[model samples]
Target chain A: MELTLGPLAYHWPADIRRDFYARIADEAPVGTVYLGEVICSKRAPFHEPDLPATIERLERGGKRVVLSSLAEVMLKREREATAGLMAAEDHEVEVNNAAGLMDRGRRPHRIGPFLNAYNEATIAWMAGQGATHVCLPAELPGHSAAVAARAARALGVGVEVQVFGRAPLAVSARCYHARAHGRHKDNCQFVCEDDPDGMPLLTLDGKPLLRVNGIQTQSESYVELVEALPELAAAGVSHARLLPQAVDMVAVARVFADHLGGMCDATEARARLAGICAGVSFSNGFFHGVAGYRHIARLGTAH
Target chain B: MTGAEDFSAAGELVCPAGTPAALRTAVEAGADTVYCGLRNATNARNFPGLNFTPEELQASVAFAHARGAKVLLAVNTYPPAGQLALWHEAAAIGMRAGVDAFIVADMGVARHIAETWPRARLHLSVQAAASSPEAIRYYCTHFGVRRVVLPRILTIPEIRAIRREIPCEIETFVFGNHGLMVEGRCSLTNWLTGQSTNLDGVCSPAAEVTFERADDGTMRSCLSGFTIDRFAAGETAGYPTICKGRYAAPHRPEGYYAFEEPVSLNLGRLLPELMAAGVHAFKIEGRQRSKSYVRQVVGAFRRAVDSIRSGHDPDLADLVALTEGQKETQGAFQTKKWR
Candidate 1:
């Protein structure tokens, strides 16, 4: 299968974002790159002006680029931006909400995880709406993922799964990062940039629970699915999208690419990935139909 | 949109009914519209020992209709892949029962209802999580939704802004368990337990819920072996959802309500403001509650809506005692707070 770099879900300095994508375009083996802000819309202006240049750079590298719409479109400006994204004809658009779907009309678009397409009928309905690819929700078990992937294959739609990064667990209208910093959503200075990955949330027993990123809450542990790559491909998944993180993504991509090419052992690639993302935990419970924090290495073999 | 003349009285008193008795109690207590779900995963409140059979729903609909009240069927959960037929069957059963409208959340379900049962009236369930006018307008234009339930995240002015832009009717929660998480968008419970609130319509399924007492004389509520919230001795315990639980974060040694404390939402005081803001219905959100709760809360809202129309002050003092922990807040309606 192909490895696609998912949209950047966190806020970073514009220069860092620009440099990161530049390095990916130059060195990373990722076939496709999703560029745009899928989180808070307020973070758009910081990086939007530089997007055309970044897209140009990536396209110049022979990488396919897809523009992503916001996950939750509540404001008028966010809606207009979504409509504008749909109107753009140069690149493919990934719709994350119904507003985007409404604006897309007859255009062949990609459906993001935010818009739930759980069952076969949902996928068929989305295909009828001219959706060409769909990223299943992050909480699907291996069994469900296989079922959905097979269904997508039957409908001639490519299925994508989140193979890396902290899986998003929730999205809220209120900004938890701003709330934690004692500021309202409207007037608060963007405080989510403090944690380039995401701010960690712990349980009362001092156990890590989730990461807070503005209005989105994600699993505390990054979901590493390198071992499940074979199962995903066997299930008819066409793409495994890796969300960007504050790490050497070029090395991360190379490791994933090496695994796909059968040039590196799983142990060595995993060890290399571990060295890149130090002090971070990994979990694959959602893939096993168990608690999200639990790392179940084996799939249906478990229970 | 239906004209104000269709609802010549005060704001509609929309009530919740988990059981048949609760449905009858709510109707007898003067609820203008009573909403309930079938005994399946189609509805958001898919609790055990709750909801109705098809026959029970038909009888309840006739009872409510005889009393000049409308019964709405809530089929508001996302269907998992290959399980779409279940939701379609749910809508068909609701239509057979002669319910006035269907409250739906999933886009596929909405499309199915709009296409297969074009004559059926549709209301957007809060589980759809459409808080903006653009989102609501999309549903109205695509699915012919007659009303949209506002998610519990919008302020009064935001609701008013949406009311001005959309042609659909508005409904907002006036009482019950406050979901701090955005409706329809949360999967924390699904991450912990196999069931999903958005798809299976069950959150922290009872099968995965456990309460244990610590030696320190505190009650700890756990969902799927993970602690959701702990209560001190003699402290009342709320339902263990991952969002409203206490937790510890870095730099903060003491465990606190990292998301939100367990406080119920009480918008009773803002009945007049809500009516003036163009909310067509005031919804009471407790399908898992008791028949007495259904009777008392619906009765209070009925009187409050009447009082507001007659130019009298609403009596909402008694609602405080009925709330979880007997504490309430005008959540998100007054203004957005950091907590």
Candidate 2:
């Protein structure tokens, strides 16, 4: 199965963002890349110059790039952006919500992790709307993903999973940055530039809790499916999306790529991933239909 | 929009005010009734720099009353653990200030109001997300909710279908940032940060955000710390929220909005259609907006309703500049093929 690097949910500097994609374009073994500003309309202009360049570089280097739509509600500026993305000539688009489906252009489009695809009917419907691939929401269970995958395969729609990185659990309208700094959303001084990785929160007992990303919230632990890969491949998932995190991401991508390429066994892959990703926990809770933070059968846990 | 007006108007209009200016704006703008909560978490819009101090609310109530407008105190916040007293006190003081009713959402708050003042009128808040007619009827029977503000996810057909089975006046968001997708129970905000619009009555707490000019001439905006959106130098930027930002997917080599883009719901054109669908009252969003906005938009909608009643086409104004980054959308109201 192909490995897709999901959008960088963190706002890295233009150079850092460029270099990140550049590295992926040249060195990383991933097959696909999805990129764009999916949170606030203000950030859309930042990546304009670099996005086309990176897309061209990635395409020249043999990586397929899919443009994405926002995952939450829309405002006018966002609508224009959506229209522009839908109107783009060459690449396919990943629709995060159903809003883009109303005016989706004739492209081999896919569905993003949002749109609340809770059941098989929604998946089947996306296929009818001309979705070629669909990534299930992070909160969906593995069994549900499998069920949706079977349906997708039947309808000729490719199914993907977020096998690594923190789970994107929810999106919101309120800007946490402005709220945190005692500013209204309109006057937010662009304070979110301080943290490249999302702002981290800890429980009262000092446990790593969650990371805030503008209006979107994500999990503290990364999710990995090294052991579950065989099951997922057998269940008809076409690809796996690896979200680039703040640390060891290149190495992390290599580990997954190695596993996918049959260069490493499941046990070695898990071990190498653990060595590179120090101390941060991994969860399949969303796939297992349990609490999102809980890791079932953790690495190094006595069986 | 579908069907004729089925439910007769009952109870009153319960509006919102983020500031005292908005309170006056709502009052003078022809609000039949005005609703607000204390500066604490007694109401849902508990973001900073909003709501009323006890004295201001009391004064605002007097002002509204002298102008023949009724004040409905919204003590609708869910009570935090072991903190029922804060909600209780907000309700008690609202009653003392001669509020016409208590717009309550939580069952605990409803119980508190009932036990404290048996004669008080209580309307159900939209935080309850009671969609089915059976569900709303259950609230009316148990909590004595005089009215219900229906969630915006419903179409006119759905609202008319609901009118056939409910026993309360229906209020729908007419001109405002209608949250079409998010349900009341979502924690996408809380999961990223420690605060939430539901638990804390706040979303995307400002203290956690930062934005910077990336070296590549792209501007990146983030909430908490996650990149919500990135804009090139020429593109317009709205407030940075995660769901509205563009992200990359494989299908398109270019980046796009992977969740949703930030769009405001401006259903100005659909007023005639929604009115025919048994809607008793229309609600405008953005208690967090400016007084000038409050005066213009609310007054505009008020006039729209009057114009509709007089069987004239409503005067249309391009109020886009009043919006965040001046962006607005018809949302899900106009599209029949909406997924």
The per-model lDDT (C-alpha) reads 0.85, 0.69
Expressed as tens digits, the lDDT of each residue in B238-332 for candidate 2 is 67654455544223225554444577777777777777877777777777878887777767676767777888877655334345465577654
| Fraction of native Cα contacts reproduced by each candidate | 0.51, 0.05
Candidate 1, A120-204: lDDT as tens digits: 7678788988999999999878778898899999999999999889989999877888877767688769889888998888766
DockQ of each: 0.57, 0.04
Q: Determine the TM-score of chain B of model 1.
A: 0.95
The DockQ assigned to candidate 1 is 0.57
Task: Give the poorly placed runs of model 2, Cα more than 4 Å off.
Answer: A1-303, B1-15, B250-253, B317-325
B-chain TM-score for every candidate: 0.95, 0.89
Could you give candidate 2's per-residue lDDT for residues A131-151 as a string of tens digits?
799887666567767877887
- The worst-scoring run of ten residues by lDDT in candidate 1 chain A lies at A294-303
- lDDT per residue, candidate 1, B39-75, as tens digits? 9989999999999999999999999989988888999
